[model samples]
Target: MAKKNVLIIGAGGVAQVVAHKVAQSAAEFGALHIANRTQSKADAIIQTLRDKGHRMPFASHALDAMDPAAVEALIRQLDAGIVINVGTAFINMTVLEGCIRAGAAYIDTAIHEDPARICETPPWYGNYEWKRRDDVAKAGITAILGAGFDPGVVNAYARLAEDEYFDKIDSIDIVDINAGSHGRWFATNFDPEINFREFTGTVYSWQGGEWRENRMFEVGREWDLPVVGKQKAYLSGHDEVHSLSARYPDADVRFWMGFGDHYINVFTVLQKLGLLSEQPVRTAEGLEVVPLKVVKAVLPDPASLAPDYTGKTCIGDLVKGSLDGKPGEVFIYNVADHKQAFEEVGSQGISYTAGVPPVAAAILVARGTWDVKKMANVEDLPARPFLELLGRMGLPTRVIDATGDHPI
Candidate 1:
């Protein structure tokens, strides 16, 4: 099989991780091209690839992914076989449209988030990405959604339980615990604007075959993970629940994120001060500003946290159901160290966690193991292959069975 040409559209921390992973696994893909709003960032990523001695031909270009026509032109110019949209969540649909128009396979980490709106109602994918499903199918191009760690691998874990471990699936508690300390007073793991916007809206979950929404941090629980141990993670709205519910209608899909009190206090103060609102309000001096954007401008960039980042992050899916027609529960997860991730890929723990899996998906796509002829979510693909590929790519999955912890 010929290697597929791949083009990555973002140069952020997660995009850095993806670039390193892709460069390391260059055998799966042909020529590599990276495009970003800042061409220097893309060039720097390519430089890193060269410094690492990755045996691959690489190119970099300037791109405004917001312009679908521009992205389409770039894809056509590069003759890219696959378009990995690892950029901001806001640019998802536009990039996906470019992929469709250019006749290239498209994939992204999270569901689309309108820069104008923090968090919309439940089944968020239905609003933007899902609307293009028919178009993608008709165009005969594949679009994979939520191929990141939590939504990507965690979603796969749930499906794995359904395939190998469970007979009747019951509940899925997707827990993401980042015990890493970036040595910063306060900073998000990824884009600050996207990070704050995620928690500010109503937390949505699929429970008992219905949609349930709540205030952020309203439902909290302590989780004793493998390395992170006992940490408090609150039920929060996530991209996986929306797609997971569509696949496993009877199962309860919930997402919980670990956060410290210090972070909560800071978030609370910011929210109360109207610094977290997505709506733009004019200042007395006639400056129009979105509260969230203003706050994001002041906060530290998630990528900067890499060098001083310490500790590990444990993210997994706690799946409960029937295996032998009796109750059974298993936690399938991976623990990644910040230092190790930095040493290997020049990225932090969170970026490593969210970034690695999609490269595996890209490899699978190139290998013809995951190229479905339509738009789909992570669960829509075969979960085992993706998980197995991730095991070889620095992030290994372990399962907690009744007996003890073991490899998946």
Candidate 2:
């Protein structure tokens, strides 16, 4: 059978990585098309592909992803079988609607976050994406949410633990530690506004059939990881915990992120001056401005960090449970290198880690191994294939079992 055509949305750093990987695995996909709000950015990533001598047939277009009608029209035009959305979090619903209307599978890295709100309440998926679940089911389209690293692979870790190692999972601690550095004084590795907004809101976690909320940095601890040992990570609100809470209501779910002293200090100082607020306020000249927006305007774009990025990132799920009626716990994780990712995909380790998985999902959708005809999350699919794909794609998974750490 001929492979299905794919349309990749967005032209950011993650989108660049996705395009390269999709090109590398073009045999698994038919035509690979890309679209973005800015035509030049889309063309630029395609240019990289041409430089690499990619054999895949490629095309680029200008798109306003906020418009469902236009997006659906483009999908019909391309006859796309899968839409890989690595765009800004703001345009998720429109693109998903487009995919549903076009009768194509959909995949994305993170949950949709409204530009107006810093953070919504607990169960963030229900706020916007989940309401479309019934419509997706009615249309019989596969909509996979949060297919990125934390929300993406971490979800897979939880499923792997539940399926292979545990009889009854007691607790899950999702940890993301990036020991890599960009050699910059002060900057966020992702969108500055989005990064700051994530922490400024309530940190919600589900434990023992109850929800707990705390302020950012209010709870923190030190963890000794595989390569980057003894780093301090704080319990923070994250995208995966929201959906995991719904899936495993009985299991405790929480997320922690590693941060250095410099980042914390800078973030604290910016926040104290009200520069991180999403709300717009008047300046001395009476011009309306959102402080956080201004900060993002002045900060370095995350894509620029790749050239100077060095070190590694260790991310995984630590699951504690009963195995054959005996209490046990294990850490299932992947470690990525910045230099290796830059040489392979022209992106930093973080973006490489997040970008590669959704492309794997897209290829599986093309191959029919994961073309389930309904809305699903990464955890709802088999983990072995996904882990194997990552292993070949530069991010390999290793399990710390009772015997020792080794590849699965």
Estimate, for each residue in 1-408, the C-alpha lDDT of model 1 and write its tens digit.
667899999999999999999999988889999999999999988888888888788999999999999999999999999999899999999999999999999989999988877678778889999999899999998889999997899989988888988989899999999998988888888888888888888899999899998999999999988988999999999889999999888999999999999999999999999998888899999999888888888889888889999999999999999977789899999999999999999899899988998899999888878889798898877888898889999999999999899998
Per-residue C-alpha lDDT of model 2 across residues 285-334, encoded as one tens digit per residue: 99999899999999999999999999999999999999889999999999
What do the candidate models score in CA lDDT, each in turn?
A: 0.91, 0.91
- Model 2's number of clashes is 0
In model 1, the runs with Cα more than 4 Å from the true position are none
**Deviation from native of the Cα of residue 324 in model 1, angstroms:** 4.0
Cα shift from native, residue 394, model 1 (Å):
0.7
**Clash-forming residue pairs, model 2:** none
Pairs that collide in candidate 1 are none
Model 2: CA > 4 A from native: none
- The worst-scoring run of ten residues by lDDT in candidate 1 lies at 114-123
